[model samples]
Target: MAGTHGIHVHGDVEGSQVVVGDHNVVINAALGSSVSVRSEGPPPTRRRTRPAGRALPDRAPQLLGRDRELAALERWLGQGYPVQVYGPPGTGKSVLLRRYAADAATSGRDVVYLPAAGVPAEDLVQELFHACYETENYKPEPARVRRLMGSVRALLVIDDFQGSTAELAELMDAAPGCDVLLATAERHTWDEGRALRLEGLQEEPALALFGEELRRPLRDEEYEAARRLVTAVRGHPLTLVQAAADTTFEVDEDARVTGLANGLSDAASVLLRLLDALSPLPLSAKLLPILAGGVDKAAITELTSLALIGSSGTGYRTTGRVAHLVAERTGPARDAAKLAPALTAWAAATTATRHDIAAEAPVVCHVLAAAAHARDHAAVCALARTTAPALARSLRWGAWHQVLDLGAAAARALGSAADEAYFRQEEEVRKRALGVVALATAGGALAAGGVIGHIAGTAGHGGAAAGKTGFAAAASNPAAITAAVAALVVGGVFAGLATAGDGQPRARPTPSGQVTSLAATGTRPPDPISTAPRPLTRPPSPSRTSPRPPTKATAPPSPTLITSSPPTDPGQGPVSCPLAGGTLTLGAPAGGEATDDYAWQAFKECDDERTLTVDKTDPDHAAFGVTPTSCPKTAHPGQYIPASGPCVYTVRFHPPQSAEPGTQYQAHVIMRDDWGRLSMKVSVYGTVSAASTAGPSSTGPVVTGAACVCSPVRMPRRTQRF
Candidate 1:
């Protein structure tokens, strides 16, 4: 079916196309003999959105009471600086920037916005290039991109930005003249331009969000109680919206989420528990009933009224606080068997495309993993057959690999060697394709084979750690594979890789790929719930260090709280499970002078003596050094015998000469062990002030209820599975 084009060469690329300088990088190997691009299979598709090049993405959520924040963002962009917006979980970080991006686009500004979850940090530059240029898979040379961006001066907005300092540096390099906005739940200490901390809605905005969610103004008696309820949770928007479910809602200061479910109507109760069962997936309304074995219409309506779940694009999902609390209190629907048949049937249906089920893909992956765990061989086979190819085509290579591995494992359980062989062959094709992607992203630094993580003895997606799922072997004559890979790399395939953030990549599989084998399965770290946040003594300051030229944007942070009582481990089924726990807290403040040192300690959270690394310094103009201190390792530096004894580290911050008066300076450092994230961030005010020419000062909304101890919270990092 492949043919060389005439003068036109009519190159067809399976994915979208981006014209490069004389070289056409083809996606999906649809390249003709003449270097070009084209769709590989007869049918090629994309998400159900407007054409991708610089178009405003369609799924912007409605926001209320954010006028000031929006204005501040507007001012920051006006300053032509990069902005970093940080906050706690579920506080509408994505919503704010998304709203801003849409409005700016309507006004005809060149705006590019992308969500950064589930993507490898290394790929940030590639993704940024794609967004700015509306290119399918290519990242033009950096110098070229910078020059283009300088002239374009477009606003670049990246949501859920969790990249490292280096990743960010690369992105800034590519957009020197543009305003960049980065949002994240956790705080990055590096000097990002114009840092804005987005707090929960104040009383006014809270009421607005509540009234809108309720579809009415507060009743005569409802207003006071709503105020108290908002106060109880510090006006966090997600909580306020959930409370709006009952107009006469009282503050549930002591929230017993499990007990609340019992009070719902019969239909509502079932729906509530079902949603809790699918804890993390964003299930669409269309698929919810199917997954719940045909839930009643009233049940969904009831839950919506309760605000137990909210819309996320085409799907619905529970956010931070609700998700954790529910997962803590409930279990999946009575049995996996009850849901298996229905899910499998849905997957077997041929009506949906990648766009149709994009939001539901993660939900599908979760259930597929469950089916394999339940030994529902037939169901696993059915789901994999439909989902794998679609996943691969959408660049969800990680999930596709796992789905195939799960399918092959199911085939083995069903005693079908043929299916297993078929999956392995497809994997070889995937590995070679990945080599091209990895090499292109790496700018040809990596050996082709290094890109394939599932090589024989490495970690396998569906199988054990013994590497049962990778291609059988590297081709004996490497020339053909190398040349082909080289062609794909040179002819240009998608230059960047895209992993599904919500795609629910399969649980890390074991040697046998048996879901039932707990030891064999690898699970991602759970985000612990913080129902009662411990207040810090000092007023919570929203972190904002102005970047020299660019700025960024926000996400919600959940610093772990040590529960007085152990949370009922849902997996234990009625048993109160005791678990080992601790907290990481302050050591000593950094000395005022450039070389003056400071310290922080880990009470009981330190795991095997980890070293501290300076993640970033505000303004990055100053010098800061961090190292594991011999003393002050036991607790907060203040609590120890000597301020620096037995706990954290002795570090120092020296502001860069360019650091000006009236502007504050800060240093951020982080550490991680087996349990969760550990970090220390400190601030030192410039001694002399009054002059304000060099640095950025807050022009955004005043952070309401900003008194929060910005703690080192759980930071989620992704592992490449393909």
Candidate 2:
């Protein structure tokens, strides 16, 4: 069967006409008339209705809040200052624009309004041209647009704008003769216009809005409940109205979320989970695809329409209420798997303190935080390992500490011996960096203000180490100890522990062959290799002008050894198990002795002479024997093998007994070196499927967890290869 279709090239077609027909192109042609042609395809998808540029009512919709903003806007527009009003979704940007446009129309001025969002730039220009000229059809030439706009005294309202500043600037430039107003979910500071950031309603007005929507005056008790509802939704007007209509202003959060979810596309629904997971950090439309695992941009647009998320000056944020809803609906496993790769990429990217880089802080923080919350240890450690150097270089001490803390927690949670040790090494590096600065400043006899340590401790970790010998001790009596140490170091006096407030010398022996003090105490040094942190004391304040170096006859001094205790509770099973293909999962173990590979090396090049040794006496070591009983050997017992440089260790799981159908097992790996540093325990999980009735090799979804730490290992500089 041959199919024929009709197509129309009608010059007389009005504004944006659609021609639809199939297989029967019987062209109806008449002189000085139209010829209809048909085309064949599926039915046209439903198109979004254009927003009506309707006139405002004589009595405007009860705008209970926004009085101040409304007054300010009127004054600005009256004074002829072009204004751009922006806020998060459902904050009533479009409603305000409509009211303003209606007011302009009532004043007898020509009014041109266009819903600019979801429309192309060229199409927007054309719409503007048509509105300005009072014509349905026109070419969108910039010169013609300017000419049409200049000939009329008009108010131009471009609502729901989404684009760069330059695009808005271009629109403003074209409509030179009119007062232009833009409403958007983004922030733009136009050179020729003012930007007004809209926030939620005030308390009284928010309550008033609720009452008005409910069509009744509230009693005192109802008013209190309404106030609670308003506060819960952060005074967003739309939410209050919906609550008033549906729940009588009592505020049903679940109902509210479901209402918002109504009419949302599937992609938008999935994005809600990602946005909720990242609610802890600032989000932007630009980062939507990256964070949502490459969702289409149209889905983001739909999310905006649904008002599931809102925007600030530079980025987006899901409201606390919406975030809660999303959190309840989303699974931790889904979030971890989706966000792990994106976070890894984000941490690895080179960034700066410049404007562009600064804008990315929210996304970065959100990824790390979400991964941590999801108990995605592999993702957290991956981010930490990659971003450590950059964080150090940028001096983002607080962020660096956050990474370290999260990484350490994840390592501990995973029960990966090597992973835990890796985090400890990183922590040591951080401690050294912080301690060196404090110690060097004190030694230099410089003015060590409390702000340095105080701010670092406050911002980094709530003064977590304040009680001990590291930053906390330094911050506690910075003046006496730091000042005295600086005086001594300035006088070329090197090693000695500080004195306590009670005047007792709190000390520990220094390492071998290292001079503790210029003066020798003749006392035998303590054990040189205890990794435990020892208490430090404050030193006596020295006279400013009378600094003297200590002689060789002084008593032996204790060198400070700052360290923290290894975790005791290896941590409950990771918050969520990695799905197949995510980090921390090796494919289903082949029987009881399955081997799992890792992505990063487990070695660190350090100055310590202690050799890496498997403590066979340790239960973990005995359970998962090291492969080949030596370094540089491959294909030994379990999946893990140690390489020459720092490389990820593979683990081989040896279940006590296997071959059981419909059972799950945990593979635990714990390794340690002779220096007392313990590796994070790595746990890989797998399940034995029910025996298939068919073939012996056939199995159900073999549960798999990749125990690999997905980070590239970088060897430390200046290390001697063994």
The C-alpha lDDT values of all candidates are 0.45, 0.43
How does candidate 2 fare on TM-score? Answer: 0.32
Error of 1 at 595 (Å): 16
Q: TM-score of the candidate numbered 1? A: 0.50
Per-residue lDDT for 594-689 in model 1, tens only? 332222222122222353455432233244555565533333211101122223354444444554543343333444332333322223223323
All candidates: CA RMSD (Å): 19.6, 31.6
Model 2 segments beyond 4 Å from truth? 1-59, 134-137, 248-722
Q: Kindly list the per-residue Cα lDDT of model 2 for residues 632-710, writing each as its tens digit.
A: 4322211121223222344443433444554444323333322222322233344443333212222211212111111
lDDT of 1: 0.45
TM-score for every candidate vs. truth? 0.50, 0.32
Cα lDDT of model 2 overall?
Answer: 0.43
